[model samples]
Target: MSQELPTRLLLIRHGESEVTVKQIIGGDQSCTGLSVLGRQQAEALGRRWAEGHEPKVDALWSSTLPRAYQTAELLAASLGDLKVQMHPDLVERRPGQADGVSFSEFTDQFEWTGDVHPYVPLAPGGESQSDFFHRTGKALYELVHSNPGTTMMVVCHGGVIDVAMRVLLGLAPAAPFLLWTLNTSITEFLTTDKIGVWRLVRYNDSSHLSGLPTHTDYE
Candidate 1:
């Protein structure tokens, strides 16, 4: 009997973005792309890959957001200049009407009560927690099924990664825990022969950033 190979899923959070420095809600409409430090971070990861730090990736995917696309581009430049397949499903949680506003302003305008229902939208027209999870789950399921036994790299937002973790690990939706993934950090997962069997190989691995100046900001 031959053993089945596991499908490798490499999830990477986008580098720092302009919205992080400005402290604003960076929905698709408000995203202005990576900042100076963000470019450096992405480039560093690229260099690491270029130097054969990890196994060769078969495909590259990224969120359509500017920040994510930019990071993907930088990474592609180093990874044999691979093409980045953009997917809207990989974007961060939609902020809706609260899109380019400051956090304080969003609080004042939306009157968030610190806790919101899972089905309630984050903003007037934004996706609720439940909605975001559903979108992420569907996208991940499709990705895993579409490319079995291949190593795929996905550059997306932290929220998307969090939802992926939950879906893959069979955790409760909106579990009482938070995963603060750093910019450009890598999280890996492997799928087994058993249905719904996924193993978390690593999470938040940014070893390529040793001695490099880095900062974490709200997503």
Candidate 2:
């Protein structure tokens, strides 16, 4: 009999960093640590997942960003730390010179007119949408294909998650920005040998933010 693959990944995006709260640009450069509320969000997710899920995870993976790293640490603690792995492929898109700008500034500088309201155009020296998609596919290929356990958790950014879905769903590589990932939200997809038949398990599961004063809302 063929062995059953793992229960799919519990993919999560890190909590809102200070950059998110401030509405500042945080791409690959100049990281923005999580805000106080973001830390709380991380705690909230950890509590819920630890208390709610039945079987524990076989591994915990996170991007190298400070916000993602911290979120992963908190989650690892709650999950009892079967193992923690850091993967550089999971890093956010490098916005290059636009990393420290405000949203208004970003639009004013770059004439972005996509149907997707918040899709940022790559400023000079920054990564284009296609390039970002390429990087995202690379990340998922490593994470999803490399692991075959019953379950695993990978904490990453919203952009990475968006591109990953597009790739897994066999949609065009670029254009769409996000799959509704709120601050500290979760997005799940199940894969099989059949390829392109992945299951869309969940998206933006943020019930833990019902009462938080500083909760963030993403499109």
Candidate 3:
């Protein structure tokens, strides 16, 4: 059974976005491009992979967002012959009308009533916590089941990684937890069928980002 074999996942956060630099609340639907620094980060990560840091993977997947897709493209370029499969379901949490809004404006109208209904949208036209969580979780589950005993790389967003952490750790769906996945950082997970559990091997590894000026702010 595919589940019986160990499935390795290289869960990566996409490079920084222009929205982060401009202090906007751009989310999934946002088509914001990557910052110059973000491009460099993506290239650096690709160089790291080219240097034999990564093993041949069964597949490379990325979110449909411009930032994520761009990162995947750059990384794939460095890893000759690799192609990326873009998945819309893997996109970051959609902020809907909040997309492209200034940070101050988003906060001014923000409401936190998720405790009442996790399925309720975070904002007008935005996805609910439950919706985001389930979608990301389901995508990851499918990735694991479909690949089985192979390695896969996924370029996505911080929010998606957050949801993955919660799902794999058996944490409460909407439990509050602080997490920060650096731009182009790698988070590893291993799944085994015997226990049908996912084990986190590592989190937020950005050794490739060494000597690079850090951007402390991003969505």
lDDT of 3 by residue, 55-171 (tens): 666788999999998999998876675789989899988877888788777666765432446777767898988888889999987877777788889999998999889987798
Where's the lowest-lDDT run of ten residues in candidate 1? 1-10
Cα RMSDs, all models: 2.3, 3.6, 2.7
C-alpha root-mean-square deviation, candidate 3: 2.7
lDDT of 3: 0.84
Best by TM-score: 1
Candidate order, lDDT descending: 1, 3, 2
Residue 164: error of model 1 in Å? 0.6
Q: What is the TM-score of each candidate against the true structure?
A: 0.94, 0.85, 0.89
Each candidate's lDDT (Cα)?
A: 0.90, 0.75, 0.84
Misplaced by over 4 Å in model 3 are 1-5, 109-117, 216-219
lDDT per residue for candidate 1 within 49-129, as digits (tens), equals 989969789899999999999999999977788899999999998999999999888888999878879999978999999
Clashing pairs in 1: none
Q: Where is model 1 more than 4 Å wrong at Cα?
A: 1-3, 216-219
How well does candidate 1 score on lDDT at residue 149?
78
Instruction: Residues 62-173, candidate 2: write the lDDT tens digits.
Output: 8898889889988887888645688887888878888888877888777645433224437767776667778778878766666754477888898888877777677776
Indicate the residue-level lDDT of 37 in model 1. Answer: 85
